[model samples]
Target chain A: METQIDKLEQNKKSKEKKTQPEKEELKGTFAAVLIVGGIILVGWLGVFGLFLERA
Target chain B: MHLHRYEKIWLMLGAGGLALFIVLLCVNAFAMGMAPPSNMEMIDPEKVMETPPFDKPGLKQVGDKEYDAYMTAFAFGFSPTKMEVPAGSTINFHVTSPDVVHGFQIPETNINFMVLPGHISSATHTFDKPGEYLILCNEYCGAGHQVMATTIIVK
Candidate 1:
């Protein structure tokens, strides 16, 4: 009975290890997307400032 | 804060669209003769080849029987606000801008170039036909861009 339980625990650990890299990759992709969005926002704001003279 | 997957995608798209809009506006302005900041100094197109005379009382002359003139364009003003070139004489134009990229053109003569800040652009023309040549800033520089047009007389 002890060996059976041990086998189940090992299987679960292996599954987690296999999935860990995918999770990290998703996080990295999300970060890249955020950075690009931020850059675009700043560029637009700068152009708008040029036309902001009060009449 | 935690954003849902769809929300994140939409946010990024919105930001990208804003950037594209700004870029397009600038491009449109330039195509419409609105001047923008440049990397060169602005010189009046009329000042080239003509030098004020030390012996004469008023403005000097750089050439024989030719008077000095200037055609300056800027975000707000153009120097030598007025000019009259003699008919049948080669008039050298020294065109430049003070703050941005201004275009100098005499549509009748087909003269055009970018007036970069901190740089001098020279163009020469001999008016064979006597008439009024319109000077229009072909670059969309700012608010007054539409009314930035002026005139040059070639008699």
Candidate 2:
């Protein structure tokens, strides 16, 4: 039972170590996603605003 | 399928954005009445002129300041030739084509529709300012397409 608990704690620590690098890498990906989404939102709103102005 | 944590988060955000767009479209179309113009009213293209209302393409007062304008979009030009409405009056324009597909558009107003042969297209606009509102054919019909335009005099 003691060996099993020790194995579980080591597994959790390794998981945290692996995720630390992944989290840092995904920060740039998240920024890029937000930039792309912002462009699309701006374009859509531009057209919608033109429609309303013509209305 | 197994997905990474960031992948799941981005996927959810993308889906949420799409859902928000759909909800905005619904609200704008149903609540704000910004939907595109469409009417399923069909007629015989050949007999359009001989038809009841199309025979006399003009306006009929429907309410205090609302008028039903029956207009025809012909090959080279629009019928009736002249249309005059008072400022602040609302005109519900019911238009159609007999020869070919034409376009119905009023500048500075949200009254643009396709005048398809045998199909009736309608759009409404209120002329609050007294001026000449030009209606032009935005679709290419033939050589005379450029001249296929008229004016609505609001006085």
Candidate number of the best TM-score: 2
Local accuracy of candidate 2 as per-residue lDDT tens digits, A1-55: 5798899999999987886644455777877988898899899999889877865
DockQ (0 to 1) for model 2:
0.28
CAPRI tier of model 1: incorrect
lDDT of 2 by residue, B1-155 (tens): 55667778888989999999999889988998875566788999999999979999999999998999999999799988888988999998899898999999897788888999988898888889999989999999999899999998999
Off by over 4 Å in 1: A1-55, B1-60, B65-68
Taking all chains together, the TM-score of candidate 1 against the true structure is: 0.44
Q: What does the lDDT read for residue B137 in candidate 2?
A: 96
Q: Write the per-residue lDDT of candidate 1 for residues B1-155, one digit (tens) a residue.
A: 55566556767787778788789778878775444324244434344224222112122256764554445567765665666666766665655555677777777463667777656666656667778877788888898887777666777
Best by DockQ: 2
Question: Candidate 1's error at B38, in angstroms?
Answer: 13
Residue B119, candidate 2: alpha-carbon lDDT: 88
State the DockQ of every prediction.
Answer: 0.03, 0.28
